[model samples]
Target: MAEQSSPDWMALARRGRRHRMIFLGTITVFLTLVSLPVVMPYLWLLTMSVTTLGSAAVMQVFWRAAGLVAVLYLALIVLPPLMPERFRTWVPAMAAAAAVILTTLFILPLTTLNNFRFLWNPDVMAAQQGRSSTIGELPSIWSAMGNSFALAGTQTALILITATPAAYALSRLAFRGRETLSRGILLLHAFPVMALTVAIFIQSYWMGLLNSILGVVLVLTTLELPFAILILKTFFDAVPWDIEMSAVTDGASRWQAFRLVVLPQVSGGLIAVGTFTFLRGWEEYVYVTTLLIDNSHMVMSLYLFWVSQDAMGADPNLIAATGVIYLLPVVALYVFAQKYLTQISFGGIKG
Candidate 1:
């Protein structure tokens, strides 16, 4: 009898390839659908920023067309894993490049550039001259921005200096009431800020700290301190004591060992703490408004409020533009600190 024919390997391989492509296509379509709701509002915001009228007619025509084009382009890039073997190798790289370019385009048009243009227009500025409108009498934008930076930077520095040592002691030293102290810190952090606002104000008034940036910074630092200490203590606990002791045995003092060895080990935690403190200071509104009654001492948060309620009155576009500017720094800070943030862990927490 004739030998049985060998199995058709190429046919089986082709069948497997076809099944894989079908699975990938289904996933790609599902992801695209899931992401649309999340992405559409941002597209509308971008459309409003670039054009004077975000009318329904314009949105339906222009925005829809642009979105369809984007979807098609994304599909073309994402579906390449189903392509021939030689081309599949480049699919991931191509998809990544496309993602970066699209993200930049989406973000660039929504920045402060358009706001600056409208704010500095010759006609707009001239119209405001000697006018009694609220917008006309607003404080300088540059000044408010400067105040925010100064307050945030100073508060972050102070928190870092104070919280680091406190965290180290809590993590390394055995002292009376140490566990109670940790519990108290967590409880204090959870305490309501609004509930204590009146007491804080009265204390600030008695101490002559009201209506000053320093006063605002001090309050923000206090609110931020408990969480900072908790996070840093966890970071310190994660660091192995053996390496620190080794440095001590090499003729280094305890302080020297900590500075040279342990500190570097917790750099990620330091970054996470600094970023949290800075953002809290930067976006502070309740304490700032309640404590700083003077209009001349306005930070960006208060300035934005004034612009919305008093200055730009009914102009939603101007408000949205300002809101974009307000959000950008926070976005940038998180983007920069995300890697360090992921390094922080609560795995070492103890009862």
Candidate 2:
């Protein structure tokens, strides 16, 4: 072989860059295509929530919102790199403001909140039926929302209360069967709790918690414990032992050291676990439906289900509005907890 005289480094770099660009482009296209099926329904739900199901305005608003999101995404991608490092942090906020302004100008005019009248209108089905005939009336949306909040909130509290100590023990203290117990907890997480619904229901009934939000809360918390413990233990493990030892050496009890020192260190993990636990309880439908016999105990999930069940002549807009409402809390939680949530990793802090 004629010794390759002076390899073209520039050409090789150009080729490598081009290949990376192509690969990234292909992956982006694949992801967008994959996401469309999952995303389009939510877009349609949001559109129908604000506009009549068959109205032309529905499509108009959809396209406008989609266009705005696309533009905002492009701006974040393109503008951030162009900005100085000090100014990069402001790009997201600026993009969000621009999006809001554009939405107000283009999309707001085509949208209406009439479909969400259920918020103030107690008897939605009755109002729709003009009280002359009835397809039966359930509790008010407020009642359902209240119950959902109570269930999710209580479940989160229970998970935090129980999982914290268990995780700390698993992470710090050494004892016989400790390793086995940790593995056992992880194993339990793999078991599908839904498969044990009948047993859970029977147990709830026996405990006199049937038809009660407390029953659902307890059930959800129990099923959630394994996951919560596993996640929290990883956080506890990430806590440096020196910090705890120093605290202990300074005359602090182990519980005191954990409560004050280790606890704050793992705050992100706790929030991550709690956020997921709350969302699980919030969106849970099966257990809530099965355990509770009364409409008064209906959760947002069951409420949305009932609203959607009016297949014969139910207003699709109303169902969509309910869905949008049901989604709001989850969206809000993720938005606020995004910082800590993103830091959660399998075996260590993301940073």
Clashes of each: 0, 0
> In angstroms, what RMSD does candidate 2 have relative to the true structure?
3.0
lDDT of 2 by residue, 1-351 (tens): 898699899999999878977776677678778877987788888999999877889889999888886788666864564457998988889898999899889999999999988787766655654533333457788888999999999999999999999999999999999999999998999998879999998988899999999988888888899999999988988989999999999999988998899999999899999899999999998898899888778889988877766442567898888889999999999998989888778877877
Task: Compute each candidate's TM-score over C-alphas.
Answer: 0.75, 0.89
Candidate 2 Cα lDDT to native? 0.86
lDDT of 1 by residue, 257-292 (tens): 989999998888999989988999989999998998
The C-alpha stretches of model 2 lying farther than 4 A from their native spots are 1-27, 77-90, 129-136
